[model samples]
Target: MGDGHSQVAQKDKYVAIIDQDKVTDEVRNIALRYDPLNRAGRREGFHVTENGELHIDDEAVIEEHKIVANRIPNDAIKIVRLPAERGELVHQYGENGFRLYELPAPVKGTVGLLGRNGIGKSTALRILGGTLKPNLGAVSDEPDWDTVIREFRGTAVQNYLEKLRDGGVSTAYKPQQVDRIPDRYDGTVRELLIVRDERNLRDKAIERLNLEHIADAFVDDISGGELQRVAIAATLVADVDAYLLDEPSSYLDVGQRLSVARTLEEFVEDKMVLVVDHDLVTLDVVSDDFHAFFGDPAGFGVVSRPLSARRGINQFLEGNLRDENVRIRDTPIDFLRPSARQEMDGIPILEFPALTKKFQSFSLGVESGTIFGKEILGIFGRNGLGKTTFAKLLAGALEPDEGRVDADINISYKPQYLDSSFDGTVVELFAGQVDVYTRAFETEIQQPFDLEPLFDLVVGELSGGELQRVSIALALARDADIYLLDEPSAYLDVEQRMSFAATLRQFVNRNGAPCLIIDHDLLLLDYVSDRAMVFEGESGVSGVGRSPQSVRKGINRFLKIVDVTFRKDPNTGRPRANKPGSQKDREQKASGNYYAV
Candidate 1:
């Protein structure tokens, strides 16, 4: 109190929480008690003193309130001790960042790792797979698994590691980046899978992964999705006691994703399996239980105990671990009711006539539609249904065979295929494209998109999620009448997707610009879209894109095509895919409400 003045009688402990934005009279008095010379005649707008004093300057620009760093002496502040941990694997990064991965010693069945990206999921997987040995929180010359096992002496993970050390257990791992397979192996799909086919299940694995069409294709020539499937199939064909898969649904479609999940469950039902994925729905469907990872992304993390599939997802959405009494995230992710008011009756910004485009073996036709002002149009369909083709047509990258978008509009588009070939850093990229230093850009684009941390990093070196955030931020930074984002949710985690959806919706409302987002994330579409567009018909051969309609109706139509019914969770309002013949599913199907509220 009184700016730490000893004359005012210094106490052993004191804490004063001040509102940084609106400095109160009492707070100003406290500041003056320390520095009586602090005054108001500093500049245009406000004078923010280095000593945490605020002065009224009419011509000064008001700075946004930020969290102030603690600068008191070490003896002045009390330290809150964290609970002690005796985990199987403990890895440290920098001085304070580390991961306390607490897993069952001898992992059983299929347990999943759920969390935001860069929070130590991959590290945990690698440590378990014997690729990276655990150090047990030490910086010694040799980090040994023996010490790690000793730390978990009375734990199941210790037993698991002991068996592994004795060569009694084996493991097969599938890394997150499937494209890297081409870097290590130049062989064909069949060759890759058969090499790891110690169980003689290569043929079944290929069939299950839908690799029959590209069975003989070289790894270098196949698509991203194809590479992912091949990688999974290769690992599945191995005769290992445990399997570790990271982001198995990265580039897959709905049907392909389901098929892969089913195959994984069937092949490794009796073995120990651990998966790390961001798609909540797919994770819910595939995993029997979950180990939720919590803490600062890319900095520190703690893996929690096992939670049932349904409970895990719901708790993640709620941003809290009920059992541990730990809050992983700031706010709960809750969705507004479908019947809530949205920008439904806004004026039309762009009108398109029935459009058609044809390629060598595929053709796409879209029914006429109008995108309302300040509204987001959600596009849903499986892969190869010409979604990208449709986007390019609207972007004027391709000519329609029949009709056209017809409207004269400036568009900001983030394409499905991102070219990470930039030779400059993220800061330089933003400098050459948008004014990243401005307040508006910092608030609306940089902060919400979490692009600040990647500013100094080279564009080409960024990961999938990092690259995606950059591409999307660039798109949003530009001045355009219409925003076209194809699969914007592709590489983003669940939290990132929801954050972007909220930001995009706010941007639309503020700028009065309509946006069309084509993505496969149902919860994202449900959260961001004011209306929806359903694309149907045969994949890769013939496709149809229907006109935009109400969000409920459009989603219902699309889900009907997929033959899956979704109902909102009562607690969080997030979509939960119903069981095949569950009461909710049966009721929704009978009532013809696939996207039930």
Candidate 2:
């Protein structure tokens, strides 16, 4: 067996060398296609060996080929590693808590710390940022944070400055929650640019990020997604070597997410950028390295391959299931059942008659049978489309100017901006409201959704998924006949999104309630929704309603323009598209965009 293994290893080495030669030849051919002037230079080094192999020694080509060999270890930076301790209290009630179990050397470039709700990912980040100190674990390198900083000031002063100047190391943290700007101090987005010492570079940053429209808007009233972008903009304006962004894409939609990923890629070209996000799709595209924090006391974490990031995250959330390979199911979901349609009583819960929404120049109509009990409705459109506006109109937050909105039934609306809407603990949001629906549903809400541990926890401290669950609980706790959930599953991870869908299904099945969910996650939409609405056109006002299968077909047809193919998810059976080639395959797979049929 050892001999056979040795032979296989030898063969693998030869194959690798052969592959490298092939790649070199391909690179030369492609370079020659565009740079005709370099042909003579390339010919100087071009040769065919006795084995009939092409070789090139062009200086530029050789330099380009040396990129892999020239790669520097980014993990060389001296990180203050902490020794792992048992059950150390990182936080003592109300304050942020973290306990480091194994402080792996900073070999992985820009580690991403991901975990389930309340698992202390944010707390761990704060500890690394020097904002919070773990009560239990000690730094592996003798001196504590203060001592390290002082030591840097004392002996390593020149080295630290040199590192900073050479862009060898720097770290900045952007919190998941946006803090309130001082009311007395009014400032435009451009003014906030000055805070980061980018007053002169404001236009460059804005143009790069495409934030011209909201450049003058007050920092206070921008949309949640826009606010998130602004926060990122503030960080990008600063010249840093590393950035720790917590849930940067929490409020962004599909388009904005793509834009943000592009921006981060540019940023990471010269510096390490660690973005802790719940959206697996964005992470797959943006991250070069991935890390996950799991287990009790939340100390255990594993640095995983980038390709397996999504699977690792899912496994962490759901536990190691038997079918590990099948991460997502692609089965088409039935949003509404026959029984649900029969129980509608012929009265429309809410109808938008030629609903022409403001800010978005489009119109549509929704009838009674269109949305039935316990049905998940996916409202999809391009960004700047009136999806949010339409949601606001349904929620009674905005009055329609032209069309009649017949929301004759009791409705509970969970808006997109959950942070500003509610203030208090998770318990407080549903405490008084739970009893009101208990008698109606004939089942105690607390029993179905366990609100005990979450009673005292502040709402503001909750993760996006936790807050989303809380929002759903609060909405479900109410005795409303209809639910208008705007981007209900926006910030939730794969597990949370699925769990929320099940909860929504239960709400409809148990209490005969209906819901309209505006979301960008097509997979979730396929699973939970009974009907799909696709809003098209540049303004995204007009929409076409169709079945899940039909919608998949339409999406596939549209995505074909980009040379991508949509396939059924093996786990859930939802439709998903993927780009051609292994690079795009790895990216799409890592992103968790693979849908179920």
Scored by lDDT, the top model is 1
Candidate 2 TM-score to native: 0.65
Q: Which stretches of model 2 miss by more than 4 angstroms? A: 1-98, 103-110, 134-169, 179-186, 197-201, 297-348, 359-369, 419-428, 431-444, 458-465, 539-597
- Give lDDT: candidate 2, residue 194: 78
TM-score of each: 0.82, 0.65
**Regions of candidate 1 where Cα sits further than 4 Å from its true position:** 1-89, 104-106, 141-143, 179-188, 216-224, 335-341, 570-573
lDDT score for residue 250 of model 1? 73
Query: What are the per-residue Cα lDDT tens digits for candidate 1 across 391-421?
Result: 8888888889999675588888898766677
Error of 1 at 557 (Å): 1.5
What's the true lDDT of residue 290 in model 1? 85
